[model samples]
Target: MAQGIRVLHVLGNTQLGGAESRVMDLYRHMDRERVRFDFLVHTEKEGHFDKEIKELGGQIFCVPRFRLYNFFSYRKAVKNFFEGHREFQAVQGHITSTASIYLPIAKKAGIPVTIAHARSAGVDKGIKGKMTRWMRRNLSKKADYLFTCSELAGISVFGEKAVREGKTIFIPNAIDCRLFAYNEKKRMELRRKLGIEDKYVIGHVGRFHYAKNHEYLLHIFAELCKKEKLNEDLKNKKSFVLLLLGEGSGMEGARALAEELGIADRVYFLGNRDNIYDYYQAMDYFVYPSRYEGLPGTMVEAQASGLKCVMSDTICREVAVTELVHTMDIRADAALWADYIRETADYQRKSHVEEMQKAGFDVNGQAERMMAFYENGNFDA
Candidate 1:
């Protein structure tokens, strides 16, 4: 048997965030004999990714989290990199935080290859944006390759510089279709258990943060409930329920908004669930109203789960791999989303099963791609 390529993945933390989850997904399925994986995480608190990484026969090296402008942390990372340089053939940084801070260190360590992967749109506009752009311009040059989940994310960070330089590659986020496939029996069972078996459930699975626009989702649901109560025909024909799965700092505010709008009873807050795919199965329709995203894994998971999705325009187009998904504007307008929810509820969309199969987003395919990148510097551009 041929020897496996060794890869060291450096990430901000092991938290159950998008980038962390993507790395886990890749690690879990990569061919054991083709690519061996390890992780360098920056966090004082051990996170959910730790166990999964260990289970996959990978090692985790924890480093102090680097605050912006913290030269000391950079020096520490540099020291750590030199101490552990011999174990891996290449180092891959998964998001901007790691890429901006560690790419230079990895380059200096003389790793065979250093990859900086862009996983989101640039930082918010203003001072932070300016600083981030400057960092990317200077720090990114050290990376042998730049990988982005979408072209939009690449342009948002690197702008014309990436196109002119010709180093950025777009690799859309892939999900395990088998894990998220349509399971009618499971859907029915889960819906019955949630006591929303008869209601039209509109689902949103994500951390409750500003980017997710949960406040707007509450207002949208409120508007739909009011409309259902006022219009006798619509009321008699349809009733709606909301399933919010995930937790974050914004949870209390979102809960308060639901109460203020008097729709608390209609919304279910299932916080920080491990089996998120089951919640997707229980829903009638999926909605992602994020303000901005590189590519939402929930959106891809929803499509794989065979739920028709209604998302915001700011979400990366890479997640909309099939026609079953729909996009909305990001103005946080309640009435507009309510209208869309109603229209989407009425439309009979095709199941995404075949589409997901055709797309080849299953874990095996995704792992193969990452293995190729690690072993031969081959990535689908």
Candidate 2:
């Protein structure tokens, strides 16, 4: 029976990102007796989801990092792991940027079902990035199933022709919506704890990376500070603070930029909190100026928390499931973002739990749907 089948999910470290968070939400909601999940991550270090994954009866296995310099060694490691574990019912890979490398290894190991998933709509530029793209394009042919978070993401990883021919399965980046729904008690409590009770809080939940446009975000916040100083109605009031949540390779650079811009004191870098829902509740506005995205789960959570969201137009429109979201061009100057934020800063919070459920982004429903998909080994639905 498919009830006790185990699935292997391959990816980078299981950290706190959109892709990681969505998978965890599904894992938490899935019926454990019907389906089980195991992880094959690249890093040896324990991640934010490691303890929870273990407590849920899932095993964590690690392999050496995949690199062009160590191609032979990486391949041997993957081959050995798959050969040793012949019991995995299926292997689903979430590292779209490099799925071509590992999916072929899984296929060669005789895995019956091989799934390649796309999670982002953009890639880095330059020679190295071009080589990665070429590798992905050639190696992605080994997968039996193609999965993507959005149409643009599907096109980015698997060519437009492939997506047009119905070759990819679209999966919404679902979440536990009710947990992030507007909560006045949580808002007041978190605000008090964070010592931001009387301040205008502008929140953003994303890694500090070039793709997220953190440099531009700092400029916008600096402009907002300048504007606040000039407003006669806010002369004695404290300036709005920018709350940055999450960490990444660009963390040091982002902090340096904030300091150089003279806004270091006004920006808080809260790195990877377990209780992200409370941060959402405490925020008054959510700002995201990413260069591009597949389908951001953070924007969904922000709306679920009833925060007025301002995001880049490059992000897929499918994420705007609620009226709280607003999009602006990524090329627009920081002054424009400041003006828009100041203009829309006083909106009220309301419950959007039903709206999220109606949009088919509820984790419980998606978890069941995905379980059925794994059991049937079909993408017809």
Candidate 3:
């Protein structure tokens, strides 16, 4: 007999992105006895979450990447895997664009609960994305439950009618607020260790990608540096620092841009950090200029850490769990972004953990809610 009811999750890879991180947060807070998570990652290679998944008693399975050329093998792998392990209470797919392909297979295999979760608000451009979206929309009819991180995400993947008709459920991407809570002593200590004392630190935590708009961020930071240099009358005008975390394919481009702008010395690329909470504490401001999103989780963490945040207007306003977030249009010039950054950098820091709780983003409560759903074998309730 099985130890407990296991929920199967499907994803492209276990990379440290917003969706992956949010799911990991939920995994860490779940009750293992009542509900457990098993992963079916497409990538054959190990990921950042692989070790932790094993440590937490979760099983990880892999299938070949879904491509037109290998369509038969992909379907065969899914069929065989589900057949061999016929113990899943629910099969939840995180890659919304491709959920249609897998959820139907799970459904045909007699899995009781098939969930299609939409984590992003936008899709890639060109024929492939269009085809993927078309396939996802047609195939998503197999899912018993439709979940999305935000209303925008719901509309993007499941269609506006499904969202308006109450077919899609909006689940907040929650986090452990206490871990990101502001700490003055920690700020001082970390700043001293990094030699960032008396400096105006601007921080961003996301993969260096086209969607993240890292190039635009570098331009704006360059503008900020230029403006700061021209202003000799400003008080306490110490040096400036830009702290970037996370790694991706665009990292080389971002680094080159920083060097070209002659601001590479002030820009610190601290990739894939384990102590992200402490880094948040060390920041005076948080900058997120993502092109589009369902709801970026890092903004909430930034708010919890009491960092004054300047995010792009492309994100959902629902992400503003606290008053610290200021959203500006992505179409705005780099000088405008720099002006906003300079204007907001000196705001006071305070714990917004309680506000995050009130906004229904406290991980502990959300975890319990999900646990109950899993144990009850229904989300319709």
* lDDT of candidate 2 at residue 364, scale 0 to 100: 82
Per-candidate alpha-carbon RMSD to the true structure: 2.5, 1.9, 2.1
> What value does the lDDT take at residue 87 in candidate 3?
82
TM-score list, all predictions: 0.91, 0.96, 0.95
Q: Point out the higher-scoring one by lDDT: 1 or 2.
A: 2
Query: Whole-model lDDT, candidate 1?
Result: 0.76
Candidate 2: which pairs clash?
none
RMSD of 1: 2.5
Comparing 1 and 3 by lDDT, which wins? 3
Clashes of each: 0, 0, 0
lDDT tens digits, residues 98-209, model 1? 4665776666666778887787774755676676666676545667888888877787765658756777887667766677877788889998899887788889888877
Point out where model 1 deviates above 4 Å: 124-130, 230-236, 347-350, 379-381
Give the poorly placed runs of model 2, Cα more than 4 Å off. Answer: 230-238, 378-381
lDDT of 2 by residue, 264-345 (tens): 9989999999899989988888999999788899988888888899999999988998888899987888999989888777
